[model samples]
Target: MIYTVTLNPSIDYVVYPDEPIQLGQLNRISKHHKYPGGKGINVSRILSELAIESTALGFVGGFTGDFLKQQLQDRAVSTAFVEVEEDTRINVKIKGESETEINGAGPHITPEKQAELVSKFRQLKQGDIVVLAGSKPSGLPGDFYQQLIRLITEKGASFIIDTTGDELMQSLEHQPFLIKPNRDELEELYETVIDSKEAVVQYGRDLLNKGARHVIVSMGKDGAMLFTHEGIYHGSAKPGRLVNSVGAGDSMVAGFTGTFEQTKDIKEAFRYSLACGSATAFSEDLAVKEDIEKVLQTITIKQWEE
Candidate 1:
């Protein structure tokens, strides 16, 4: 079974305005939509749309949290989130001239609440896949992901980590199965500009040297490069006008993990990852199986066997 961990999840309230948004004034919304959001939650949603079953684990509370849980169930994704003391957050995304975001801080997770989450992690078996994604909540320590990875690795489970900055840096010591960091993140890690594919691939390799078994350096539109302990692989992004890039990376992680679980083929997995991202980029929501397959056919995966 595949398990996804979202430490901080929310109800994404996406508001579309008919006209430009005015700052410090009441803006009228033309349309609105809500989705079960947070990086790992998005991964589970996309995985379900691709016909892969995954259990979403996280902390949730209040009526808003109930709504978010129902949203996932409505999409046929299994969830086992712990009930916390505070209400879940509602992230507002006002879409008009450009996107404007106002994010809320959810409930503080106490030691007992965190222990409950760790207990859930203990249920994973040796062969199961676990994905730890998104940010650490305000109340949590920076080493949260590292601690989770250490516990999950001890269970002999394969893992995928999708986060940036120090949290991501610290988790590398656990040697996660996969880590997906976008171009900007790559730059931050190396503290240099990545202007060429060689530079990106080299930096991804550097992460592997530091203990990550597999590294995927994603370049929006330009495509993504995958580096394993064995070799490197490349897949190009599909040609299309991006409607929404919000869940694209999470979709890519889902696609890659889902395909890797089924085939254990790295290149094919990269194709699926690129396809899923492109599909999500071309739509307002996450990519479905049909859209992902269509993009999959157009993506070519080349291997750098050396």
Candidate 2:
């Protein structure tokens, strides 16, 4: 079984206008839709599209929380959320001539609630995969994921994390199953400009040396690269117009995890992950199984001769 953790989730309200807006003039919304928004939630949704079953674990509360869980349930995704004291927040995304967004600061997570989440995670059996995804809510300790990584890895369950900065660097000591960082994130981690592919592979290998079993560097349209003990593999993205870049990385993580869980082949997982990410990038929403499949045929993975 695979489990995904969303420390902070939100109801993403997307609105669209048919015409241009004028300063000091009111604009009317032509269309609007709401979707469950969070890095972990996106992963679970993608996994479901691939016909994989996984549990979503997080803290949700109030009417917005209810809506998030219902949205997941409607898509046939199972959720195990801790009810909290405050309502879950809403994120508003406006799409007109240009895309605009206003994100929310979700409700505070109490220590007691945090501990309960930890307890829930303790039940995972060996060989189960848990994805500790997204940013932490306010008031949580900086080492929150560090602690979770330690706990889950100690219990014999491998974990994947999608975060950067000190939090990610700290968790490396626990040896996460995988870490997916973008080009900018890589620069942030190493605090230097990566001027060439050699430097990219070198810094990535440095993370592997720091105890990360595998590291995936997402390079947008240029494609993504996978680094592991076996060897380095690169997957070039299929040509497509970018409809939405949101959730692309999460989709990549889900695709890699889902395929690896079933096939345990790093190469196959690398190919599938690029397809999943490109599929999402080519669509307004997270990629469906069909979209991912179409992109898979165009995926080409090459060995990096470093």
Q: Scored by CA lDDT, what does every candidate get?
A: 0.87, 0.90
For model 2, how does the per-residue alpha-carbon lDDT over 1-306 read when each residue is reduced to its tens digit? Answer: 999999999999998877765659888887889999999999999999988888999899999999999999988889999989899989999887788889989999999999999899789889999998998889888888877877897789999999889888888888899999999999999899987778889999999999999999998877888999989888887689999999999999999999899899989988888999999999988998899999999999999995
Model 2 lowest lDDT segment of ten: 16-25
Error of 1 at 76 (Å): 1.6
**What would the per-residue lDDT of candidate 1 be over residues 1-306, giving only the tens digit for each residue?**
889999999988999987788779887876999888899999999889888899999899999989988988888889999999899999998887688899998889998998888888788789899999988788887677776787888899988999888878887888887899999988987789999887887788889999898888889888888998778988886589889989899998998898899889877788888999999999888887788888888897788644
Per-residue lDDT, model 1, residue 15, is 94
Q: What lDDT score is found at residue 243 in candidate 1?
A: 90
> What TM-score does structure 1 among the candidates reach?
0.96
Q: The CA-based lDDT of model 2 is what?
A: 0.90
